[model samples]
Target: MQETKPQAVSRATDEELLALGRDVLTIEAEAVVALAGRLDGSFVAATRMILGATGRVIVTGVGKSGHIGRKLAATFASTGTPAYFVHAAEAAHGDLGMITAADVVIALSNSGTTAEVLTIAPLIKRHGARLIAITGNPSSALAKLADVHLDATIEREACPLNLAPTASTTAALALGDALAVALLDARGFGPDDFARSHPGGALGRRLLTRVSDVMRTGERIPRVAESASFAEALLEVTRGGMGMTAIVTPDNHAIGIFTDGDLRRLLGAQTDFRGLAVAEVMHRNPRSIAPDALAAEAAATMERARINQILVVDESGLLVGALNTHDLMDAKVI
Candidate 1:
């Protein structure tokens, strides 16, 4: 074996380096734009095929195409389509068992003639699984073998030598996104559906978290009767630590709310509080929300009403729970 010596590279000026970066972006952007214009009925057909598939979508490829395929599979799955990526070489080594007759296989190859992918194409077809090929060459074997072919050909690579997969990979990924989005629309996938798939994400918290999930229930909610003394209401607010206390009737119906802010304003006004009643100081018509409403809707209401806390009431207008800005923050719903 011969040892290879490294060569000294010439350093380019800052402006020259930036120019190269800009050129790469421009080339890749142009490739994507051109791909959008070249979209025809084949794109529509691919979407319809995936939408109609009774089983999962199996995305497979090799090399750079494999990376794109993996991302495409994740996108499809996250957007309501059941899909996953299987490396082409692995499929040849028995991973092909994952594919079923009802599955749809999406194969990606820039040249449309990857030997590893070609090796398994027949086996996939033998299983009676449908194939959708994304390749640069429409006449290539993979394209011809496919039930539907998506042309992802780019004018040229963004690589300086035009040998690396740059613009071509971008085009394929964009085409996959287009197909996934179209299928999402066809399935009528809404934010709630998306949130279900991403339960740990922020969107999920905003969409799926109801006020009842974060509101303080039972003894955690600070409550004082409307006939209670002002000092008793202040004591409940302090003990509750929610900065506010709900003033309820004898039957637990919320009548008004009083907060520390109200106390501060009262103190500033130099009002005598020796024998004041909670009903005398509490703000009537305090903002309230149903326990079943979204936490996001509760946050919106709080913001619009310029209040830090809201009382949760049932259909009968009985106090059920209470939450503040801190609770929303704790739930990560804000």
Candidate 2:
């Protein structure tokens, strides 16, 4: 060939991808909205069934529906309801033994006629376990055979191709979240209760994080006499690296505190830093908290008082330790 033409390279720009994302989100939002509108007496029935359950809630599903079911089970378990996931295919085998008279089973299938789920409906009934079905089809075997049915149907999948389970799964997941939250609210589940169930998560930190857990102890604490010189207080604050020193009296009672804030105020005021006593410049009757008090409470106290440092004291008013805003931030108590 004597000459050749250069072909243009094709790639999606950010705007094009963002436009596609907006379409996907809009479609999925419609699915969730449709799912909300469909909620009626059936949703109440499902919530009542789950609330009346004195035993674990066994959730079962197949394929992508199964993945949504697993998340639903976890949410229920974390939010005051006891629940677990059982793969539908495994139920046909000896796994059915996991179901007992005291258990309530919630089965999910978009078609409601999923062979894996239909295969064990009879066995679940035989065990005297109550059955609840979440399905798209009303007349399907799983829904007809169940004690209660919760509708989670969607108009169409958000997939441009119309075959993938995109919006359908999103609708199912949103419905599951609704059920869990309703049951949680119905039972008056509080933050403290949720923290107990999730001791390893941030909820635990907010609810269980105590002042003593992150506070300094013994010799590491910054302490000085109320009558101590400014230089001595500075030494104590420097040694602790917390930018503050606790001022205590002869009886070991906390009298005041000298912090970096005090230092700035003093420097700006042109006070006699070289000769002034710490007690003169320090904050008198400084606000403090108990060791057993929650770290969140401490953070709130710090913020409300507009102070960066606080003294940890005992019931007898003796200074036990000191903590700065940095300590709370480091522990995520703030």
Candidate 3:
């Protein structure tokens, strides 16, 4: 057998790059997965602690964790949990008043030795509040002092340099999301309740806004007497821009609707437009809705019946209001 020449090593440096990515992914995935197994007594205990709180949740963190803390606090507040973020440094500098005995405190630290976080530990304990810690080090003072410690430790950083905080921050953020969502689910938070809290949102607008909000009442409503000339009704329609006018008797109950559609028919039939009255061309006993119907429901009716303008009358069928598709668009009911 002929002797084979030995292949020399290429001295390529790609192994470290590939291994760093794999190592970080593996550790971060394990951290999140381990959360499921560790979610024993602590998870339930945390939820009960938060739900039982009579005051807000005070979240505190240092450096990179502070950025995540602010977002978490905002999420909780907006979703009805009532929370606020406090910088650990500021907490040591008289900002501790932001927290009270009735509140629950959640502290975040990766190594658990962040000096700023440690400085406030004694105050947190003295406040008689429940302290929950999220950290990578269980033996650290911040973790040891906490009433409940959530382990967010990861084996390695995602950075190739392994100096910058990456996987650790990701693990902490994911854990925060898990905690918030779990609490939200336990509280049975829902859309209707959410809309109440966010009344400026679209869902709230649809639920809270009534037909009266967008209706044109009094002088803005286009109305014509049955005795009025077709020319007079056309003037009302042109002024109101609703493309229609309500035909009412002297008592003010809507008896018919005179529309642009009626105008087309009247003209095509070559009626003596100069002598015709609105009563001759108006649609008799046209459909009308009460002023109390939901704007969303009214919009639906308009779409289903192919009507652009609807007269808003009372239970007695008195023409008190008017609305068009443009009103729905302006109100965002569409």
lDDT tens readout by residue for model 2, 1-334: 6788798875989898888789889999998898878899988998998788778899999999999999999999999999999999998988998899889899988889999999999889999999999888888899999998888777777777878888888888888899999999999999889889988856689898899998887898888997799999988888989889888889889999888878888789888777878888888899999999999899999999998888999999988877888998889877
Residues 1-334 of candidate 3 have per-residue lDDT tens digits of: 9999999976657997678668888867776776666666776777789999998999999888888788888878767688999999999999998888999898999999999998998898899888999898889889899988888887777776877888788888888878888888888987666767778867778876779998999999999898998899999999988999999989999999988977888679877877878887788998788888878878988899998989899988899899989998999988
Ranking by lDDT: 1, 2, 3
Clashes of each: 0, 0, 0
Q: Give candidate 3's TM-score.
A: 0.63
Clash pairs (backbone) in predicted model 3: none
| Best of the two (1, 3) by lDDT | 1
Task: Report the Cα lDDT for residue 191, model 3.
Answer: 60
Name the candidate, 2 or 3, with the larger lDDT value.
2
- Alpha-carbon deviation at 304 in model 1, angstroms: 4.4
At residue 282, what lDDT does model 1 achieve? 93
**RMSD per prediction, one decimal?**
2.9, 4.7, 9.7
Candidate 2 deviant stretches above 4 angstroms: 1-14, 201-203, 300-306, 329-334
TM, every model:
0.87, 0.87, 0.63
Candidate maximizing lDDT? 1
